[model samples]
Target: AVRIVNKRGQFMQEAVPVGEGSMAAILGLDSDKIVEICRSVEAESGEAVQAVNFNCPGQVVIAGAVNPVNKAIEALKAAGAKRAVLLPVSAPFHSTLMQPAADRLAEVLAPIEIKDITIPVVANVTAQEVTSGEEIKKLLVKQAAMPVLWETSVRNMVAGGVDTFVEVGPGKVLTGFTKKIAKGMTALNVEDAESLEKTLAALGK
Candidate 1:
């Protein structure tokens, strides 16, 4: 995973110049309204701004060129968004602007040895479980430049009888999202040894 992500980071840098693109989180707005606002911003500015991340209900992230990103932020605020804030990041990820990066990543992945996994994995681009190696490979490439259907992915898992989610590694942002996305579902995070212990105890229950 590290090897794959390292190349992805390099290609992301090459895809867009530093400071040329930006990302913003739009809070307390429906996804449909956010999409409509992004369309208006793109038409007016003739730049690329898209609703990229559907993190949860009322929480969407947009990414594109700096000008349009900011324009969308203002418009979202005026459209009655609770908070539309610019994110501190170097690149506009998971937007059409990252197509170049996706293209590069495709080339890098074509020849690598990727075997099919037995366990199901929900793809970010399609919001569906993909088990075939080839299908997973294609989805991974598209994920770089496509909107992440995180909310849909989580709901799919809920429908599949997954009532508990254990997020390994750092951060509780996903744990928060799961709580909001699937109310009453158990969400646990393991960021350190102590957290891991707690997570295991919770799972044992």
Candidate 2:
């Protein structure tokens, strides 16, 4: 089972839908472990399963693995899912499955005029902060087909003296990962008007 932490407390009482296709988190395993597991599962099941999202330490979210996924797929099946399939993404992503996508992204980015980074944006590919525009561009392209090092990003941010983390996305996914990475740090998520107000009040803004 995946240990999903709710950083903002918003997810503490939320109901998330089982998205299109199938998704499962390889629990008690790192990215490499998950990849190996996916390969084995795929070979036996003859399905197109691959590691997709990297949320936090020792957790790797995998999609595809449709056939064997039923045996090891988390929560969803118990929640009444019959089977999960590979997502409709261009490629499998992150598991050496998206080399083609990476190549394509490289081609697309080669001619684009990228602007310099004005702020310290963390590289999703490396989970390290980068301020150089050129490096950012390359990293961005790679990120499309690479695993997100969110665990590293949060750990590094805490180590680098970030006491507060504010997530501004459609889901509270990043904040949840941050909480798992840095338990001592203050983290918040702002996804709606109420959430925004709560965040401002929490920060005493």
What TM-score does prediction 2 earn? 0.66
lDDT of each: 0.93, 0.63
User: Per-prediction TM-score, please?
Assistant: 0.97, 0.66
| Count of backbone clashes, every candidate in sequence | 0, 2
Off by over 4 Å in 2: 1-23, 30-32, 36-50, 63-91
Q: Write the per-residue lDDT of candidate 2 for residues 37-117, one digit (tens) a residue.
A: 667667876766666677877666675424445544643334343443434442234534344555555665577666776
- The C-alpha local distance difference test score for the whole of candidate 2 amounts to 0.63
